[model samples]
Target: MLSLQLIRDKKEFVAERLSIKNFDAANLLNEITALDKTRRATQSELDELLSKANQLTKSIGQLYKAGARDKAEAAKSRSAELKEQTKVLSAKLSETVELLNKKLVELPNIPHESVPAGHSDADNETVYEEGEMPTLPEDALPHWELATKYQIIDFDLGSKVTGAGFPFYRGQGARLQRALINFFLDEAIDAGYLEYQPPLLINEDSGFGTGQLPDKEGQMYFANEDNLYLIPTAEVPITNIYRNVILKETDFPIKNVAYSNCFRREAGSYGKDVRGLNRLHQFDKVEIVQIEHPDNSYATLETMKEYVANLLRKLELPFRILRLCGGDLSFTSALTFDFETYSGAQKRWLEVSSVSNFESYQANRMKLRFKDKNGKMQLAHTLNGSALALPRIVASLLENNQTPEGIKIPKALQRYTGFDLIK
Candidate 1:
């Protein structure tokens, strides 16, 4: 959410920036302006009423002290009338404030100046590419086939026990999954991120804090009995740790990382796109989050991008980074960079991670603030990226590393997996 002050003071400027995001803010802007006016008017009236009531009380006390019994009785009557008026005005003020908040949350974050004005992933800008595309044997199999060949992953077993998209790892496949999780966490820790293991089930407030509620409510798995939603990413719980917190200038850069089994409904998913490890209901991921001063945030975003790139390099995967256009950007992100790895057998680039800088959108929603050098409170910029998402990375590794003999594991992960190849 953007600050209400920004909307009111620079209505036209804000509306123009939102246009870059393909958001027609004309009606919503008008709606917000009107609601804010009503809220202010109601509050003014309530304040005046309270002031009058207090004066009446003082008059009643004076009358009683002077022994003017008749005057005191009349003053008491006026005081009662003012008290009733106050209650009515207070209710109106509350109603107006609530309506104002509803309108505010409907507005998406303002796009950064660098955000390209366009629609869809096709309009995204490719900012970086690295590594060579591997030349695989003609007999090389896609990840699902390779999984079957090596007896690593069991999709059929998962379907029988829990339905599709919930895969069961067998023997070496299970070990490989564990190894990937540990490796990702180790890498994040080495980059100075504090590790956290957050709750898989989060309450409504936590969801709203991360902008996952309202807009994306249907995308998450809801636990109806407890009214909690299963986390779609570790980013939710980990970022919400600083909700409603205020920090000093010394805490300029707050970094955290978490490993979790994420769940999503992925409703309406079908066909080859969702096949095998391409998409899944349950998947493993290591997430990195940061809270930083506004002046340092963009620099920190670049650092995070490089860190994720390093991971791909170590894994020896051919990868590229795309700067997402407004349409493809997440609702809460001001700027986003998506990392895609080339899946050799699939002959397509699969998205493996998205790193984003939210500016102050999420911080405004969660009240995550810090005191500046001037000792004034300001909203901190928030950012989170997948250090690595397991499924697609696993798919790329299996597809690209396949040989007639076996699938060769990257040397960096050999110690973790306890084997150089899955035969």
Candidate 2:
């Protein structure tokens, strides 16, 4: 949620920044300013009435003490009138505040100045690229086909049991999934992030804390009986741990890593590109979350990008990093970098992870604050990224490392998988 003061004092600045995110801010900002003015006026009027009532009450007390009962009774009657007026003023004040708050939440975080201005993924700049796209034989098939040929993934049985998009990972496929999870978690732990196993379902506030609820309500599976939503990412549960917390300056930069089976309704996303491991209703991901002092947040973003880059390098998969254009960026992120892997058979780049720094954008909503040196509480910056998501990585691994014999394991993961080949 945006601060009202920002809309009041820095309206132009906010408007310019949001333009980077392709948002038009003129009208909504105007409404916020108008509502804020009415709120202030209402509050001032209430304060004046209360002040007069206090003065009258003090006179009434003095008159009663001097035995002037009649004067005191008259003052008391006036105080009652003041109280009645105050009730209506208070109601108006509450309504104005609600209006201001609604407009504030509707505004997304302004994109950082450094973010590129564009409309779609095609406008995203390739900030970095590593490894070479693999060479595969013409007869090579994609992972879905390879899975069926090898009896690794069974989609038909999954469809018969629970409808589409809930396929079963069998034999080597299941083992490989486990190996990937452990490898990602171990790598993250070694990198200094404390591991957490978060609950798979969360309440409405938890969903909003991570910017998943209000905007993407249809994208989540809601349990109407319990009023809980199945978590779309570990980021929701892991980050909400600091909700309503006031942190010490020294305790800042909270680094957390967690593995979760993310559930999404995948609403409105259909058609050809959603094939194979490209999209799924449920998938596993390793997430790294950080709450940092605003000063160090951007630096932390760089570190996160490097960490993800290194992970892809270790896997020996060809990859490129795209600086997301405004329209392609997530709603709550000021700036984002997407890591895409080359999918050989699909002839496209599969987005494997997104690293972003939400500079105080999420903190304000979560009420996640930190005390400065002077003992003043302020919102801290929050950052997170998929250290890695499983299915697509597995897809890239199978496609890039495919050989006449079998799929060869990357050296770093060979130890974790307990074998060098998936054959």
Candidate 3:
């Protein structure tokens, strides 16, 4: 949610920036402005009425002391009328404010000036590429086929127990999943992040605090009976820990990380793109979230991007980072960079992480503020990234590291896996 003051003062600027994301906010801004005007006018009227009623009460007391009964009675009557008017005005003001807020939340965050104008992922700019794509044997199999050959992941068994998009990791596959989780979590903690195990279920307020409610509501798995949502990412619960919190300027950068099983509906998804671990209804991810002072947030964003890239480097995967174009940006993010690892057998890049800076967008919604040096309250900036989502990372690791002997584990992950190869 943007501050009402920002919209009021920079309506044109706001609308123009929103255009980068392909959002036509001219009409929405106009409606919000109109509603705001009405709300302010109604509030002024209510305040004036209350002031008048207060004066009338004082005058009525003086009149009664002077034995002016008729004047006192008339003053009381006027005060009652003013009270009635205030009630109507107050209600109107409340309603107008409510409507204005609805319109405000509908507007997506303004993209940073550096964001490129584009319509889809294809238009994203590749800012960095690292390592080397592997040269695999012609008969090398995709992760799914390899999993079956090794009896590591049983998709059919998972489907029998639940449904599609749910696969059971068995034997080495399950151990690999555990190893990755520990590896990612340890990496985050060593990088100054406080580890947290957050709840998998969140209330609507938590969802909205992270800008997931109205925008991505359909993508979330909702428990209708409990009115809670299954978290789509640990970012929601981890970042929301600071919701409605006020911190001193000294708490400039608050880093936290969580590992969780994320659930997403992935509606309308199909074809080879959704095959195997490319997409999942439930997936494991270690999310790193930061609440930073607005002044240092962008710099913090860069550090975060590099941090994720380093993880890929350590895993010895061929990776590239793409600066997301306006059209591909998330609703709450001012700027985002997506990291993809080359999957050898698939002959394609798989998105393993997205590091994003929300600036003050999520902060405004969450009312997460800080008292700066000047003793003024200001919205803080929020950022989060997938240190790495396990599914695709695992997929790439298996496919790229395949050998005649077995799938060789990267050196960095060997200690965790306790073996050099998965056969």
Kindly list the per-residue Cα lDDT of model 2 for residues 1-423, writing each as its tens digit: 777767788999999888888899989999989998899999999999989989998999999999999988998999999999989999999999988877888899988888999999989999989899888888888988888877878878888998677789998888888888998899889999999999999999998887886878899999999999999899999999999999999997689999999988898888888887889888899999999999999999999999999899898889999999998998899999999999887778999999999999899999999999999988999999998998899888888778888888899988887888878
Superposed model 1: Cα runs more than 4 Å off: 57-73
lDDT of 1 by residue, 178-294 (tens): 999999999999989999999999999999999998789999999899999999999999999999999998997899999999999999999998899999999999999999999
Instruction: Tell me which residue pairs clash in candidate 2.
Output: none
Write candidate 3's Cα lDDT for 1-423 as tens digits.
888999999999999999999889999999999999988888888888888889999999999999999999998898898888888888888899889888999999999999999889998999999999799989889999999988889888888998889999999899999999999999999999999999999999999999998778999999999999999999999988999999999987899999999999999999989889999999999999999999999999999998999999999999999999999998888999999999999999999999999999999999999999999999999999999899999999999999989999999998898988999
Give the runs in model 3 whose Cα sits over 4 Å from its true position: 54-77
Q: Which ten residues in a row have the lowest lDDT in candidate 3?
A: 85-94
Q: Give the TM-score of candidate 2.
A: 0.94
Q: What is the lDDT of candidate 1?
A: 0.94
By summed lDDT, the worst window of 10 consecutive residues in model 2 runs over 1-10
> lDDT values of the candidates?
0.94, 0.90, 0.93
Best by TM-score: 1
